[model samples]
Target: MSHTFDDQTHGADITRLFPEQATDTRSHPSRPKRGDLAASTADALAAAGAATLICTGHCKSEIQHVIDHISRKYKKVNMVFVTADTSSLASFHEAGRTIKKMGLQIDGFIGFPSVMAVPWEMTGDGHESHFQRNYLCYFLLVNILLDDMVHGSRVVLVTSCVRTEAPAPTWVDVRFSNGEDYHCLEGYSQSMLAMILFAKSLSKMCGDRSIAAFSANPGNTKTNVQTYISMDQMESWLERKRIEGEEIPVSLQQTPKSLAQGSATILRGLLDPDLQEESGAFLNHCQALKLPHLDFPAGEESAQALWRRSQEFLGAFL
Candidate 1:
């Protein structure tokens, strides 16, 4: 664990780079009041309407870097970054509380807080397993703030195309803290499969609200998630890409994205007006792509199972 945290903020670390203004608190006439904004605000920006985009995750430097780049590029779009850890119930509650108190109209949300592993382990606070941090907490995040989002608000949950590449689970239980293993890649992939189920379920759940939920594959552009893989795996991937014309960022765990490039997929997820009709759709390379065959469950059956599973795990918060 090269980087981990309890509730404490780590300084000067790229992973802890959230803005000071995003601190979890209420009524700080100066603070929060809380939140994040997006790129779909041209009309909103012209009318001076504030569009909030809540981005929850730990990697501060990366988050800050993305926000700063977006701010500079879309000068008219008033983009605010509400950075918070979405790895646990407490942090989600703290973040949700502050954002609720602030009363900002959330137009979009991009959740990128996820992890992979060499083996099973507890997360930063030891409250949940790596699988929980990567997947379940995201479920909690949407349920926590779904009320704050108005009709037509968009949500893009960043996931890997690995969901399609790997096998689905034999079960749909949301808790991963039993301290178990079903093989590393399979376990990690199940959580991703859960992401697809959640999007499908939540979109159907909120059909009345008109809130759109989507899953996004950022096209293998890299960030810090690569470090979890051994160099052998990365190099093997690199070799495959070399034989073909394709070059991805997995060579010895090296990433191909610059700061601006890393932000592009998320920006597309949050800003693309064309995606409004693609609710419950999977966005591969930022376009509406067909979903892979879901082997476990299908239609409202899977969605209901997931909704029930989420309620069981996150019932306290909901």
Candidate 2:
């Protein structure tokens, strides 16, 4: 059966609400709503002669296309692309060194680099791929660059609605060993759930430094993140959810969002001044959601435990 997690309609049109906030709406007629928030903010940073850092994993060429377009259209904002293989912890350290070498103090950071529904595998660092890439890499990168981020800088972790569908994680067996019992969705969902918990913990950990962290669910938008999942796997997973009586929310299954629509919520979390005090909040549909019905241990203690466990996992770097 399907469930509605919030009163706000799922996949509601949010990109157009802040038309005035868009920076290049006239150029791209089909651009996602509020998609220009980043451009607008980048413009402001450019005006002040500040540098903004954007990181990508495998989609280098496509992002370069957008960067080139932005560079040509908006003379004020200068965008630079960095490549980091998140599957390896050393790559994150190297990324930190590279960014530090550039001498840029980050003003805004959006951590949306993730993998979804891939087969159960381990990174070179000996951790599950999803846990290492989706969650741990973000944790390490932010911590590595934490001191360089100016006060009041925002960090946004792009989570998903599937986080609500995660089974309560067995922290003792956090990696969900690559044995026969493993399902790809479990690791993906665990990483998603960990992102939220890490955001909450990060907010508290960085509260005194004036750094705010948030986890955002960018409704359902098809992106290259789904490239690895086969049709057969998805069908089997859905059927299993049915037979096992799992809570499949209609919002996640209902509408396929445009790129701009999918990014609207993450942009809100990044650029919305009103959410300054709402750090560690879970944002969906451009609104912060209170998911009291989540059947998992996503509380302060769990956040702390996850933090310590992550620190242990990456102890060599930290």
Candidate 3:
């Protein structure tokens, strides 16, 4: 049977997990409504002198609303829609084709892959495996961005925080080619490392003209991310916590902030004037924040090795 975990439940659990860190105050100050991201994007484009935009994701209605909003607010800028399941490179290419059909010169491309995944074994090493998946998603996005940059197009990598210092239920066990299974811990670590390395590599490769690689970790926002965890799983997890006398309230379990709220930081990263100077840095809540300490560094050798291995594993798909 399909089970679901509501936002309220998950939010409460998250708050209880890190009572000190999870504040009741709304995480995003200028949180946009669902369709407002487009207006924000237009404003960002105006500020950056960008003439065109390309967006990728399944949030077509939300994204389209943003585009329509932009058209109404700033009719001068060009917008192109590319629908693709970003988890797969094939989807990305398909999205690219759709964008080409729109007949707009692509000035910038934004990638938001659906969900994060990483080898499960990496978690035992004290790594955030979810972040590892995130990092890989970003890496693939960057690969597309770099190609765009080579052809003279700017690109933005959009992401969010799936794991915090507090404990949460892990729903997936991602396996790597090395026959290693990584839980959530290692996945998060690997993902972040991949992002860092991707940024560093893009900066080095393109120098000043490198496509800017900005990372944004939106604070708590209500969304469907918790759907991956079932009520049964959440209850079981909560039961375990209750036995330990954890002071978690049921109200704290609400879904994260709305997609608009969660997208705020990412929108800011795209629009912030200061970001030009901080291209390779990760931003948290729309502010430049220090990179979290990663268990593994995605150094050049490591990335090259990963690319080679992944290519071999995927074979012709590579």
Q: How close is candidate 3 to the true structure, as a TM-score?
A: 0.54
Local accuracy of candidate 2 as per-residue lDDT tens digits, 90-135: 8778877777687776756766646787787888898888888888
lDDT tens digits by residue: candidate 3, 205-284: 55556445565554444333344445564465456557767644444344355544554555544433445666666555
Better of 1 and 3 by lDDT: 1
Q: Which residue segments of model 1 deviate by more than 4 Å?
A: 1-83, 123-128, 163-177, 224-227, 231-262, 295-299
**Greater-TM-score candidate between 1 and 2:** 2
lDDT by residue (86-127, candidate 1, tens digit) is 455667666677777877766666665356644655566443
Off by over 4 Å in 2: 1-51, 58-62, 163-168, 224-232, 238-245, 249-251, 293-298
- Candidate topping TM-score: 2
Candidate 3's C-alpha runs over 4 A off are: 1-50, 57-74, 97-107, 116-147, 150-154, 162-193, 224-261, 292-304, 310-318
RMSD of 2: 6.7
lDDT of each: 0.51, 0.62, 0.43
Error of 2 at 47 (Å): 12
